[model samples]
Target: MRHSQADTILQDSMAKRRIKEVTDAVTHESPVKKHLENLLENKVELEQVLAQNSNIDQLVKAAGRVQPNPVETITTIDGIHPVVKKKSGIKKSQIVYDNDYIDVDYDTKNQPFRHVEQDDCKIPNFANTWNAIVDMRQSKKAPVDTMGAHCCADETQDRPTYEYQTLVACMLSSQTKDSVTAAAMDTLKQRGLTIENIAKMPEEELDSLINKVGFHKTKAKHIKQATDIVIEKYGGRVPNTVEELVKLPGVGPKMANLVTQLAFKRINGIAVDLHVHRVANRLGWVKTKSPEETRIKLEELIPKKLWAEVNHLLVGFGQTMCVAAGPGCSTCAANKWCPVGRAAVGK
Candidate 1:
């Protein structure tokens, strides 16, 4: 018997045994341990043969070829015999027998479909988010405070660049509300809110300025120290890289990436704040359980071209539409494309 004939017998027998094993595992209501024991016993003889003939050195060299092992039946059913037809101009009805088989086909164009495992962080839906946001912005359907609205801030001196302001504000915004951070920045700007002024201000005075924000005492110390470092090390300018920003006393990946995106126009980094992280996972854009994990995953799945805008869109979307604990998916623009929406609608 040729290898081709043997493969058919092996595959058919294996398929039947697999079906029986699965059925028994599911239907057996007795102790799970007993059912598992029976299943293991059923495969014991086959396992021994496989263990004995485990040398698969030939497989490595047999590229673009399919090989089948010997048939090992777990149960004997009547009227069933393992046989396969040859492919050398033989009719399909012509039967042959063997313990093993092989199939060699050189036509790569018509090869059977192959499935490959993807990395957990590789998300294909990320571009959809970018396209959706661009559409919403073009149609004037996005919120008033979306990142697109600040494109002119870099050119105009009246409004500080959102990235620079965002970094300072985020530093002050820690453990504090957004409203409070805005108010604190407003008050600080009255005293000539430059790096020099911030570095020279006494800790007590800086604390007074940001006292309205949360953790004002600790934040005040960080702000003063960070400003001093910026003046001394970065020459009165905040470093734009994530590595440099994270080295500051109070900055983390979120704040650093935000600074990178907002200040320097580095769009390859993603800022995964609570809002971005929550909405990403909730939307099944990324299945991570933590913000840090979500950030790493987003960096992998999101195309570099769209990385800068992902956090901005998700943050804005999370704020106005997908509120935590009560996401308004019904009225969301991306609702049609969102997996979460489909799950919610039972589709």
Candidate 2:
């Protein structure tokens, strides 16, 4: 009887399974020894079987206990086997906030993007760089505090009206630049912006005082609304926590965080603004789309101990060496490691 292709294919499959069964049964024996024994018993048959099925994938899969394929190791530029860790969403990349210090899990040998400078370029440590800049800038002159008007409330000669004035200043500073906000505060100081003054002050008169700032008219209304809430609800005391601070009119995370930072010396989160958002991303410390996202990213990477200092350091840097446009990157202290600064210098 002539055997068809199907019958021949079935015999070939049976032979492979029998080989797997035999190989699996002798688990205690060394693989090489068992193979040799099988070879000696049916040397001709085994040779034909080996030639027909050169690939061991089927046998390996059919075996009850299979030895897995080895994971190929990659060597880094330094010739070290880098410690690899898998973060859920992000691709393998390095975040060198400071040149002197680096925290990375994977080798940068195969990174998709190239740095402007060589890999071995000596970058200053993040902590040392910031501390030096802070000291240098602090010695030079302090940046105009956007909330200076609010803070002045605490320095009032009359302790009875201190909190009232400070809360008003905080509200006024929202959506206003420091210079404009400071000018607005000056007007308020000249004519008491106390809650009693604000609540009783005519809407037209209140808007006229802070008219120099952005959104003065709406702010005037919000000031009155916030003052009424403070007096009626919290007994005229500004709440220290973010939860309570946000309850005030037009006060979001930025205002809430700032108020507590200045008024109560409490910091629950980093207060991000246009400046903080720009400087953090330029420094290669955070990859965020918005100020709110930047605040969250900064909180994760920056140690809790440095939470109070971020707004100050970044804002100062933004105003000075890291200005929004025409920044003086050529003379920046972090120019060597700062991608933005280095590119500007190259330009």
Candidate 3:
């Protein structure tokens, strides 16, 4: 047989052996049986076999002593590893197939059509700007930084009424990180800090409840005050307008915009947090010193339709790609478009 044919045969034999080993592992009454079962189900080629043979499921159930959740396993073909779905509700599986691969050949003469570099380097018209940014963001040269994965506000579980939740999260997020805010939210939920509960709780008791978070005393006070305003003034529901939201104690523009966006799905305002400000300046998109200034500049430059996603994207991008000091511009996909990054490269 030809060398290529022999290699293919060898690979096929190895795949078969791997499948058998996986099957045998699943059949054994071992602790790893559940994991092996998931692995087999997630593997594209193996899924076909498992679907044809009901014995595989029986073997897995018998060995593991537990019925696995019938999750839709997504697989790719470019040598990507299989991903098992977890019950944690967080989707981490992006690679869909083992054979699905994206190859960018540097030496190839027939390059794929991509975003064109602006020769004049002048800001295009507002309509053209939106399209240009979108095209660049989608291209390899200026690919969007998706560091936070699905943990961002946009990706979180859709609450029926997120106004109260958004307020609580924003308050907790002050002088705190997202992970910390999530924990504090969980703690508050466990302690029943709903609109009704918060309205009823005494100020001192509320303080004690949220004492784990920084500035808990002040936050508790603000929470009580806000809850009272919501109950007495707003009929026990969080306000929809940014002006009304910011009228509450401890509610600034950043918090107000966050609450407005996440709770009411309103894109009328921009959340100009520190991350958004820093990243915008670094990219030379908005020449502003403060987040408040950056917000106005961005509103003028970027379209209103993209206002909602800007904060989430820029915050995630800031955390992952553009560090405040000593950013990794060389590996950044937005380097081509970033003035600061281009300057760094020139240096």
Best by TM-score: 2
Give one digit per residue, the lDDT tens place, for model 1 in 1-347.
33453344345656446534543444222222222323333343223223433322221122112221212110111011224444332321343222111122211112222222333225655445445644553444333242222221223333233444556776875544455666677776667666666767899998988888755776888888887787788776677655567668777656766565556556435667777887887777788755666776776676454554566556666666777656776766666667887666654
The per-model lDDT (C-alpha) reads: 0.53, 0.57, 0.54
Of candidate 1, the 10-residue stretch with the lowest lDDT total is 71-80
Considering summed lDDT, which 10 consecutive residues are worst modelled in model 2? 72-81
Off by over 4 Å in 3: 1-161
> What are the models' TM-scores?
0.56, 0.60, 0.55
C-alpha root-mean-square deviation, candidate 1: 25.2
User: What is the clash count for each candidate, in the order shown?
Assistant: 1, 0, 14
In model 2, pairs of residues that clash are none
What pairs collide in candidate 1? 3-101
Give candidate 2's TM-score.
0.60
